[model samples]
Target: MAEKAEDTGVIAWLVETVKTVFWALVIAGIFRTVLFQPFWIPSGSMKDTLLIGDFLFVNKMAYGYSYASCPSIRIARLGVDIGADDFCGFIEDREERFFGADPERGDIVVFRHPVDGRDFIKRLIGVPGDRIQMQDGLLYINDAPVQVAPVGTFDEVWERQGPLGNTPSCSNGPVGPGSICQKERFIETLPNGVSHAILNVGDRPGDNTGVFTVPEGQFFFMGDNRDNSVDSRFLQANRGVGFVERKDIVGRADRVMFSSAGRSMFAFWTWRSDRFFKALD
Candidate 1:
């Protein structure tokens, strides 16, 4: 009789434990999907402003909830290729968002690609009905050139960076590994008086683009690393990000929660203590 009672007690404890774990996971998933989403800087396109290994959380509440607020878990090695559409696709292609608000110019925004489902981060340069152009590497809005002042050069090691092992582009030619790769840095003030650092790696094709008139309900974005970025300056048909729709906007990146200089975040010794909780300008 005592043995039977002990067995029943053990079974009850196990069942309660399972229920607790299941609820915990459900709550965490909801929190991540509707409140904040974690993002890692995977490329150097926004270099100087955002580094290759900086990690941040996108504030989903800043611009209200959209279908893009749903999380897309894509771990290639694990064969997991989920997307926002897979989770909240029924709400996609809708022009309206729940409690929607527009993103201001110069805000660092994350949004889903108009064609592909990949997420991209860039500085918002043009809102709807704005004309954007780049002439001789100078940004112009509505035929008025934005103010740019030369700052010091941005320097980094000319070596493989992050897990992708991408080589940094330098204004100075043919820089070898272990040497300083330098790019001309400047402070660009937009029409709205917002200022941010931008890098120039000599002249590139994107520097001489014709005026692009942003359509209604769409926004234009560009990377701070002007020459290397494939942004709205380029066409989406050619693998570049064209104008992004308002419904696709996920959230704003306000701060770097953590940063790792090494290839993997698990490398404790390579953690960058200085960038933790560093607010973005």
Candidate 2:
């Protein structure tokens, strides 16, 4: 009788623990699906504005949650690639819940890469029906030149040693040692009165692009690191992310929750304390 009682008690405790864990996961899933999702910056394309190692929370409700907005596990269970171009089936049939607003020009958005379906974050430069062009590194929207004010020069050199292979040199980066790269920085103010810093590495091919008309229900995005980014200026056929459809956008990046300058998360000395909780313009 004593043995049976002990076994019963143990089973009861196990059952209770399982129930607690299950409920916790459920609550977490709900929070992640309805509120915000975390993302880490992996590239320097948005340099100076958003840096590599910057971790931010994307506000999913900023532009509403579509079918692609479902949590990854749920999406996986559905047996579909949520990042695919046709994940939402049809552009006209895309469904969103709690639709509160639309993304504005100058907003940094996280969206599915139009070609490969990878998640990418960039500043929304053109809305539907907007004409965008870059000439000699100057940006023009609807034939009006956007204001570009010189900020200063950005110089940095860094080394990356990790599982991905050792990168001994980096340009305009936070890495340590080696060849230092200098780039001109400028403040670009959009027509909507939103201003942010942009890096210019002289003139590149992207600096002289033909006029691009944003189609209905599509948006043009660009990286702050003008010369280095492969954004809407290039075509998808050329391995560049072209115009992103509205249904592909995941959310808006509102702020930097945390940032690190070191190679490892455990490196306390490399923490960028000043960038913590920094709001994106």
Return the top candidate by TM-score: 1
* Tens-digit lDDT string for candidate 1 (1-281): 99999999999999999999999999989888888899999999999999999999999899998889999999989999899999999999789789889999999999999888899999999999999999999999999999999999999999888888888999988888899999999999999999999999997999999999999999999999998887898888999999999999999999999999889999999899999999998
Off by over 4 Å in 2: 73-100, 161-179
Q: 1-281, model 2: which lDDT tens digit per residue?
A: 99999999999999999999999998987787678877878777888898778889989988986754554421455676544334434442463334746799999999877666677899999999999999899999999999999977876664553223234223354434666667888999999999999988765799888999999878999999898787999999999988888877889999999988777757778889999999998
Clashes of each: 0, 3
Which sections of candidate 1 miss by over 4 Å?
A: none
* Candidate 1 to native Cα RMSD, angstroms: 1.0
| Model 2, residue pairs in steric clash | 158-175, 158-176, 159-176
Query: How does residue 238 of candidate 1 score in lDDT?
Result: 95
